[model samples]
Target: MSRGTIYNKDTFLTNVANQLGRKRQTSSVSLPKWKKSPQYDVFSELSEDALLDEFVKQCEAIHTEVIVTEMKEIQKVCEQVIHDLGGESLVYWEDPRFIKYGIDNVLEKKRETGMDIYEWSSTKGTFNIEKAERANIGLTFSDVTLAESGTVVLFSDKGKGRSVSLLPKTYMAIIPKSTLVPRMTQATDIIHERIKAGEKPPSCINFISGPSNSADIELRLVVGVHGPVRVTYVVIEDE
Candidate 1:
C-alpha cells in the first residue's frame, strides 16, 4: 500500500466509528428484572360475562363470526349453519366433548340435509384422511380464547390434528365461556404453570385469529388461500 493510502486496524475502526457516530460496545450486559407494571396485568380482572361480551365483539371485528348459544341448543345451531352454508360434509376433532354436548348425535342422524360428519384422529387411515380433506367444513374445540386479539387457542394432539383446521374450505370452533381469557399473556402463564408441574405440551398450539389470507401475489388480498376462507366461533355458555 502507498504511504498516502496507509491504514491500520485501529485507524479503520476509528474512521468507521466517526462516520457512524456510535461507540463500540464491548461489555457484556444483562437485562434488568421484568417487573409487572400496573397496566401490564390487563384483562385478569374481567368478569366471565364481560370477557364473553368483549370476546364476541373482538372476534366480529376481525371478520370472524361469533355465535352465542347454550349447551342444549348447540346441535340446532350447528345444523342451522351447516344448512345455510350448504355444507355436505364436516370434519370434527375426535373429542369426547362433541358427544357430551349432543352435537355428534344430531349430526349423525340421516336427514335430507345430506350432511355427513367425519371425526379426525391421529391414527386415521388413508381413506379417512381423504374424506377429511374433501370435507366442506372443519370443526374443532378450542380450550381458550384471548378476547383482546379475537384469538382462539387450539392444541393439537392425538384426536386433534392441524389438518382438521387447514384442510377444510371453512373452519369453526366451539369455545366455552369458561375458556375465555383476557389475552395471550394470561393463557401463556397458565401454560407455563402447567409445564412447571411436569406436564408435556402438545406438539402444536395454534392461535387462530381470522380466516387464512394472503397477498403474496399480484398484491391482491385473497381469503382462504391456504387454509379456510371462513372461520366461526360458537361460544357456548356451558356454565
Candidate 2:
C-alpha cells in the first residue's frame, strides 16, 4: 500500500485563492484578545508555598492523602506509605525520576522483604498490564500538577503505561514541588508551549484528581469505581 501526500494541497489552495480574487496567505493567524481574561487571574498572587497548601487542601476535598517530605526522606516516607497501605505487590513506571527521587531504593528494599515489584517495560508487552492488574500498588511521577483541583498530569509513553496508574488497587504519585502550578490554565499553556516548540506530545496525558469517585449507584457517593480505590500524593517539598 502507498501513502497519500499533500502534493495537491498548494494547487487546491491556489485555486480557492484565485476564485476569491486573493493571494494565498502564508503567515500564521493571530489569536484574538478577549475583553476579560479571568482564567489566568485565579491564584495568581499566591506564592509557591501557598499553592502547595491549596493543593493539599484540594486533595483533602477529593479524598486523596497528601504527604509532605524532603528529598532525603523520600525513600523512608514512601516505604512507610507502602506499609500503611498494605502494598504487597507494586507496579511502577520505568521513569528515571524514580531513581532520582530514591523510589528505586525503596522498591529494592521492599523487594528484599519479599514484596513483589514490577516495573513497566516496553519490551514486556502485555505482561505489563497483567502485572499492573495484579499489583497492590501503582506508582508514578506527576509531570505537571494543578493546585486548584489537586490534579496530577501523567504523560504516558511506552515505558510509562497508563495501566500503572489505572489498574492497581492503590495509586501513588511522587510530585516534585516545582511541578505545581495554579491550575489547568497553566498546565495547558505549558503543554502548548512544548508542542509549539516542535516537541511531539505523548500518546496519552491523564489528569487524575484523587481516587475515582462516582455517584451512579443509588445516588450515594462511591469512590474508586473505575480505578484505584486509594490514592496518595507524596510531595517532595525541596525538590
* Runs off by more than 4 Å, candidate 2: 1-27
Give the Å error, residue 16, model 1: 32
Per-residue accuracy of model 2 over 1-239 as CA lDDT, tens digit each: 25567778989998999999999887888989999999999999999999999999999999999999998888899999999878799999999998877789889988998999989999989999999999999999999999999999999987999999999999999999999999999999999999999997887999999998899879998998999999999999864
Can you give the TM-score per candidate against the true fold? 0.78, 0.88
The Cα local distance difference test for each model comes to: 0.81, 0.93
Worst 10 residues of 1 by lDDT: 1-10
Which residues of candidate 1, in runs, are more than 4 Å off? 1-33, 37-40, 110-114, 125-128, 215-221
Top candidate (TM-score): 2
